[model samples]
Target: MTPWILLPRRVVSFRMPILRQAFALQALHELGRLAPDLARVRAQRSLEASLQSLREACLTTLGMELDTLTLFDARSVVRLFAHAEQARILAHLMDERARTLAEHGDYVGALSDTVYAGQLLACSRQRFGVQRDAGAAEALERELPKPGP
Candidate 1:
């Protein structure tokens, strides 16, 4: 687990980028579905880039001391929770995107996204508590292709 320290000054920094990436991913999904083959490829690449960025933002806030959050002012703690919520939303979005990718036969990319989203969901459970997203994660896990013997 990476050691995380959440300072008051650092609280507001991550929200915008993560939110922006989430929106971009949502937009790219629509474009990827409707665009020409070449344009679809470009949209997929851009979506991947946005997903990576969002993952990094979430990673930075994970592994923090939940007890230590009380040491900070209330505002910082609220911001931290908001950031975690944003991460949760993006993880679900990624899971949806992964399902689309799987339907289109991009199994490798689909698997990667599904696994990463599961990790994010697990981290959310750890950082907070039993989240409502557990069932969704289980559904995604079941959707993964079974390995060949």
Candidate 2:
């Protein structure tokens, strides 16, 4: 599979599986940027495993178990229209994964996951007309470090 960074920015699709992969790639890219030397090497290995799970989710009909929940359900009734709820669930999973990464000293990966979680949440709201939750994306915005001087 092509590495996420090599994929063109405009190539990302609205499809749920594709979006999940794209976000995963983006988070991995950020991990490369922000993690320290030893941590970056360790995180690359860890995140690669996560990416493989995401790849399997994209390719298979069966759901993949992730952190106590299955993020993909190809048979769901809602998938007939759009994967809005799926996206929301994946966003929640991303947040949880971020915490896990942070606990393992992959803070850059955690930040990237949180930011993309917010993006995925916002995308779900806009695309499927899901009602906005007041507490959702705002905290992610707060977590983003301000621009450097």
Candidate 3:
């Protein structure tokens, strides 16, 4: 009689073009969440290169465009790899923007952006199921140290 042996099989997961685009968007969003202030500060120049790289990677790998994937739609994806430090950075940046606007006498704009920032921070926390940390919204508010009169 001959002895039989079993071999393990490897499985591969395939990602579609749309899915790749979604992933890229999620990456960008997370980058924003990680360093919101840096993102805003270098919004035009810095991120462009990385954004272009993602675009090219998607196009070459999956043949798709990045714009079709919206940030809201990418929320769940972003949460999967959320980094607490980055999220905190983003919160701080948003708070800074709000403060700057207020100081410039643009109360309405300041309030609006501040609210938006808060919403983003909340979404990140809720989605990632992360406990509020030192860099969270509360910390951001206190540390912002808004300019005085």
Candidate 4:
């Protein structure tokens, strides 16, 4: 009788430009998550250049157009920010088709943006304070939703 042996499958690694873009996008998302308010407006504004920087980084690092590469589908991206109140402010800034306060020469949109930004800032500060007082890194973790088992 011949002995039979199972062989491990060969591991293949391939470079994916879209994955890189997705990672960069995730970094941007994290920035938004960590600093939802205008307290870091300057830092957030710098991210406005990130989209272009991402494209350039892709060309230089991966020889690809990161902007052209679709990482997260539209629905997924929308869902990701759906629960975030600060996203309304970001949406106004990011949406090219959306009307702007400047376009209408009205203060209402700008005022709303400012108000939302303040709310986000307050929420972040409160969370930080809670974590600091509780002396537990996991304190704020409970405030977040748990993933499905």
**Count of clashing residue pairs in every prediction:** 0, 0, 2, 0
TM-score of each: 0.35, 0.38, 0.39, 0.26
Q: Pick the candidate with the highest lDDT.
A: 1
Ordered list by TM-score, greatest first: 3, 2, 1, 4
Query: Compared to the true structure, candidate 1 yields what TM-score?
Result: 0.35
What C-alpha lDDT do the candidate models reach, one value each? 0.48, 0.48, 0.46, 0.35
- lDDT for each residue of candidate 1 in 1-149, tens digit (9 for 90 to 100): 23355554366576777765465344334323322332334346665654444343333333334224324543344345433453454454456557656656789978977876666656666654564345434433443333335
Q: Which candidate ranks first by TM-score, i.e. highest? A: 3
Clashing pairs in 1: none
Per-residue lDDT of candidate 4, residues 49-105 (tens digit):
434533443344223343442343333333333223222223323231112332344
Clashes, model 2? 0
Question: Per-residue lDDT of 1-149 in model 2, one digit per residue for the tens?
Answer: 56676565435443656765455444433322332332334345675565444433322311434432333332232233234544544564566567657867799989987876777666566655644333223432343333334
Off by over 4 Å in 3: 1-81, 132-149
Model 1 residue 130 CA deviation in Å: 2.4
Q: After superposition, how far is residue 80 of candidate 1 from its true place, in Å?
A: 7.0
Which segments of candidate 2 are over 4 A away from where they belong?
A: 1-81, 132-149
Estimate candidate 3's alpha-carbon lDDT, on a 0 to 1 scale: 0.46
Task: Tell me which of candidates 1 and 4 scores higher on TM-score.
Answer: 1
Which stretches of model 1 miss by more than 4 angstroms? 1-84, 131-149
Error of 2 at 129 (Å): 1.4
